[model samples]
Target: MSDHVEEQEMEAEALEAIFDVSFSVVHDAQPFVWSVRLVPVDCGGDESEELEHNHVAVKLVATIPPTYPEDCGPELDVEIERGLAEQHREEILGVARDEADANEGMPAIFAVCEAVRGWLADNNEKGLEDVSMHAQMMRKKKDEERSKAKQEQKFESQKKAEEMTEAELEEIAVRKRRADGTPCTEENFLAWKEQFDKEMEEEAAREVAEREREGGSNKKKGAATEIKSRRDAEREGRPTGYELFSGKAGTMNLEALEAAAEEAEEGSDEDDAVTVEDLDVDENLFDDDDDLDDLDFDDDDCDEEEPEI
Candidate 1:
């Protein structure tokens, strides 16, 4: 037997053993013809549950030439018996042919079958991806349609308004009359009310802000005035109201005390002055041991004292 014929026979036997029932010999002559069903590689998933699942089983036909496995490769054709896209069928044929070409001077049936299977697997994955992309596109289309519907509704409303006759517009205004029998459009009441509410809120906010500002200013001013008054009283050597009321009257210097007593005497009228007899002291509130003679009097106290009117 010829070397090329032997090689072809060996390839046919190997393919039949590997593929079993799926492999068939059409002609067993000088130009041998056989077909092998090609199944794609497994894509790890429950493919039966997938919506975009596509399982490929292409029949690859090969014809061995006299120059097979030597100077030339086998003639190859693809038959999609189970059904596949024409584009994919052509692409599978191209891949098989390319594999055969690469295995020139060698048995290429197994390599060609594997190449076609790989192509089917890769294309199946791409189709699944395309399905995902299609879902996204559909979602986007729905959103656009909703938006368009809204716009169309608005356009229809405007068109209806434009198509209304003058009398129909008047009737609508009458039907929308307020409880006081005044049409809303007669004075643009809604617009005016909106503006009025906005202005009122702005005014109220301004008033609140003004009151807060003034209150803070007055508080600071009162605090500063109180502090300045205390400082002045201390520097001028005078009694503060707190000192007088809190039994700290002696805290005032003698000079300030004397000056204050003299000012009080000068401010008093003769009729308002009290004599010793004018005092209504009970005198019994004191103990019997208390005596007027025990009171110490300064020698110049009489000279400084005011005389009776």
Candidate 2:
């Protein structure tokens, strides 16, 4: 057969097979470029309405060549719906092209169309399953995180309570009950706490002031103890250093010691008198040097012998 005749026969067969498929022309012109939208007719759920509308479907814009498929394959552009992803569109196109190439130069438009329809139906089933499972997983993760946080907070609260003294914990429980607006039925504890809560800061300040007063009283006690200790050391006769050298504190009590000191100083001049022999000097040596030649004097001798009177 001639090349032109064979191509025309292939074109007629391809058109007859796709007669059921709804298609439009390129740019509204009745040209060779065909724009086709294919939707799955029997997808049971939300996608079933696609059979009634052109806007929601897989789209194919193809240019079928006059030459045989052996020399020129159909140029196909596949598009998925707006909300759908492009990766699945590629998968659908790959299956469709494989089907069309298998029946080359023949009525293979239906094969390509059927391949696309199968992909869409599978996508619809798997999409619902995966989406439902993903939502369940997200809810589970959120619940687990919230539960973990609550456990950690509870552990911290328990540790804080354990660290407190028994008395301190009782005080805290009292205050907490008041803050939570509890009823005063429990031994009137709530009413008592309510009265204090109004002046809690001032009460804390008063506690500090009481401690300071106690500290000052302790200092006074320490000073009195020190004074008593010093008086005890003096009574024990620890010399107390010089009896007369004591300052105002010693003199205030040392009347007998001071009188004895006065008596001792009064006799200081006569009682402490020094004779000429005490200095080892000659008494008549100022008369002249009459016995100087007769006396044997040493040059290094500092003391002179006393002459008889």
Candidate 3:
């Protein structure tokens, strides 16, 4: 046959001669198969001493492929005779696979068998305990990784929500469904509407109280000497005393004048005197952007009526 098949036969014969009773031909067809049983050495005892009471044996089955020892490695399987756990058998098989790969494109069965024998000798004393501990540690590590991945996913979802715009957040909040995906009913809507109206009334009362407090503070600070504040002037739809003199009414104010004088006194003449960066305007004043803030409207000015629930 091929040179690879001839080399395989020679290796099998050598193994049989070497192992004697421990080695046997499993199949002798075109693709040869054989098995060898390995006994662990008593490392602590002399060569002539008998094996320890806890001695264990493993069986290695080698299936020679058509191109073994030339282009690829043989298919190897390992089995423990007794005493040792299955994980130990797997660990020894891994050693055999590594040895086979290291000796590719040459006679490798002897090298793999010797490697396995060395592993058994090295781990003979504590093989079962070590394997059990290793399995437990691996299970714990896998569980921790699973939990960490879930926590990372949750953090990413929260971060995404935080990055959403205010309008997007409000849209999500306005969804008609509950957290569990149930649709809102009329009773639920009515209850929510009542609570929402109550909250709005309370908020309006708080705003009115805040404005009255500010007005009282302004009154205590003499009205003429200091000039009317922007909020009072906006509410009255007229200019302050400073605005009446500067010809910049509705546009400039005391703050802008002070900023401009500071800039000019420090030797600059920029024409844009009132910039957003130079002022701390109240954002609430722009909330209702109707151009007719100067005009007064009664409740009867609106024609649309609220829809009947």
Among the numbered candidates, top lDDT falls to 3
For model 2, the stretches where C-alpha displacement exceeds 4 angstroms are 1-21, 27-31, 42-48, 51-56, 125-309
TM-score of each: 0.37, 0.33, 0.39
Among all candidates shown, the one with the greatest TM-score:
3
**TM-score comparison, 1 vs 2, better candidate:** 1
Model 2 C-alpha lDDT per residue in residues 1-309, reported as the tens digit of each score: 656446645554565456434555564222246666666563333453653432336777666665545565566778875334555567777888898788876645556767777766544422322336675587467669879999999999999978999999899889998889866576698778878797897889999999999999999999999999999988886545554343333332233433334444456564454432334233444456776667653532313333222
Write the candidate numbers in order of decreasing lDDT.
3, 1, 2
User: What clash count does candidate 3 reach?
Assistant: 0
- Ranked by TM-score from best down, the candidates are 3, 1, 2
Two-way lDDT contest, 1 vs 3, winner: 3
True-structure RMSD, every candidate: 23.0, 25.8, 30.2
Q: Write the per-residue lDDT of candidate 3 for residues 243-281, one digit (tens) a residue.
A: 654435443344464555456545664664444566644
Residue 76 lDDT in candidate 2: 71
What shift in Å separates residue 23 of candidate 2 from its native position after superposition?
Answer: 1.5
Q: Model 3, residue 243: displacement in angstroms?
A: 99
